[model samples]
Target: MGFDLVSRVRLYKVLERIGCSPKQFDGSPSTPSETNRGVKQGCVQASNLFGIYFAAMLRHAFGGFREVCGDFRLNISLKKTNIMGINTQHPPNIHISNYQLEAVNEFTYLGSVVTNDLSLDTEIDRTGSASATFAELAKRVWENTKLTLTTKILVYKVSILSTLLYGCATWNLYSRQKKRLNIYNLRNQWKMLKIKWYDHITNNEALQQTSIPSIYTLLCQQCLRWLGHVCRMEDGRIPKDLLHGELNQGSRPRG
Candidate 1:
C-alpha cells in the first residue's frame, strides 16, 4: 500500500485502541482538549501513568518522534487517588497543586513537592515475604508492559479490524449528542491516542519496521530473555563469567 494510505490506516488503529470509532472521528476538529471530557476514574489514572511510562520507555529505548505534540493535556482526578496503600501517611485531603513542581520529561510521572515529609513509595504494611512479593510485583509489571505494548502495535496497524471496531464505538458515543459534538476535541483525542498507543514502537526502532510487528511473539522473546538471564545467575553457570566480571569493571586489577 502507498505510504499515505498506510499512515491513514495506522491513525484509525489508534482510535480503536482508545475505544473510539472511525465513523465517529472522521473529519473531526483539530484541537479538542482532553480535560473537558468525562473519563472513568480508573481510565484517568491509567492514562496518567501511561504518559510517564511511555516517556521513560521511549528514552530507555532511544528513539525519535516523527512528530511531537506540545499541547497534549491529560487531567487526572485527585478524588480517586489510590496509594496502593500509601495514601494515609500523605493525607488525601492535602492539595497537590500548591507544592513545588518537579517535572520529569522522560518519566512523565509527576509528583508534588511534599512538605509533609512522606515518601510515596515507602512500605506501609509488611504482609508478605519480601522475595515472593518482589517476584510477584516484577511479574505483574512485565505482564502489564507486554499487554500495553501489544495494544500499542494494534493501534499502530489501524487495519480493517481497527476501523470497523472504532467506527462502531464512535458512532454510538456521538449518536446521543449530535448537535453539540466537539469535532475539535475528537481530533485532539486521536492525536493523543496515537502518542499514547505507539509508545513501545517509538522506543524500539525494530518495532517501527514497514511491516506490522507480532505482539505475542515479541513478548515471548522478551520474557525468555529475562528468564534466561535470571536462571543463569541462579545456577552459577553463566559462560564467560570471569571475562564479564572483568569487562564490567572496565579493566582488571593487577596483583
Candidate 2:
C-alpha cells in the first residue's frame, strides 16, 4: 500500500534510526602533492538503504517495515517495488524474505530519468522534446496578429524557454549538445519571428532583434547562479557540504 502522511513519518523515523543517509560523491583533489586530502578518490560510503553492500541490512529493515505495515493493516505490494542499478556492470540479485526484487536499468524519480550509466543524454532528449511540444502548443500565440512582438517574446520566454531550461543548472553539456540545443532554440525564435528557413538573417542579428541572449549563455548564467546559491548555503546542507568537501585528490581537470 502507498504510504500515508502518518505512515511516511513513521517510515522516516525508522530510516533515520537505521542510519540511512543521502548519496555522496568523493571527488578527486586538486593538487597531486597534497597528501592530506581528507576523503580519497574512489572511496564511497553507502549511506543509501538500497545500496548493494547493505542488502542484508535493507532486508532486515524491510522486515521491520513489514511488521509495522501488518500492525497498521496495510498491504505491501512487492510487485511494484523495483531496484535500479547505476553504472553497474552486472545486475544485483537481491531478495526480501521469499520475494526476489526485480532490477531495472533506468527509472524516473522526481520527474528526472536516472539511468545505469548516469548519463544526461536521455534526460536532454526528453527535455528537448517536451520543450518543443510546449512551443508547438503555443504556436497560435506566436502567430497571433493582435499581440505585439515584445508580448510574444515574453510568452515564449515564460512558457517555452522555461520548459527548455528546467533543471539545466545541473547539466554538464558537451559542446555538440550545447550547439544542438542552441540551434533548436534559434529555430524556435525564428519561427516566432516568422522568419523563413532560407532567411539570410544571422543568429546574432536574430538574437539582437529578439533582445534575448543565446540559449547557451542563458544556461551558463543559470548554472553560475545556482553555484553561487549552493556556495552560500549554510553548513550541514548536502549541497553545501558537497561543494566544500575535501575529497579531490589530484590536479583538477583542465577545461
lDDT of 1 by residue, 1-255 (tens): 001111223333444566654443567655634443333556875465444434433443433222221112223333442222233443343334553223221121222222233332121111123224333544443234555655543443343223212212212122223212222223222332344554644423343432333333333455566556655674355543532544645676663
Candidate 2 per-residue lDDT over residues 41-98, each given as its tens digit: 3446322422332333345564576675555434557777778777778898877678
Off by over 4 Å in 1: 1-36, 43-70, 74-125, 128-255
Q: Which candidate's TM-score is highest?
A: 2
The number of residue pairs in model 1 that clash at the backbone is 8
lDDT of each: 0.34, 0.70
Best by lDDT: 2
Residue 112 deviation, candidate 1, in Å? 19
Show pairs that collide, candidate 1. 13-158, 21-166, 21-167, 22-166, 22-167, 29-183, 32-184, 32-185
lDDT for 68 in candidate 1 is 21
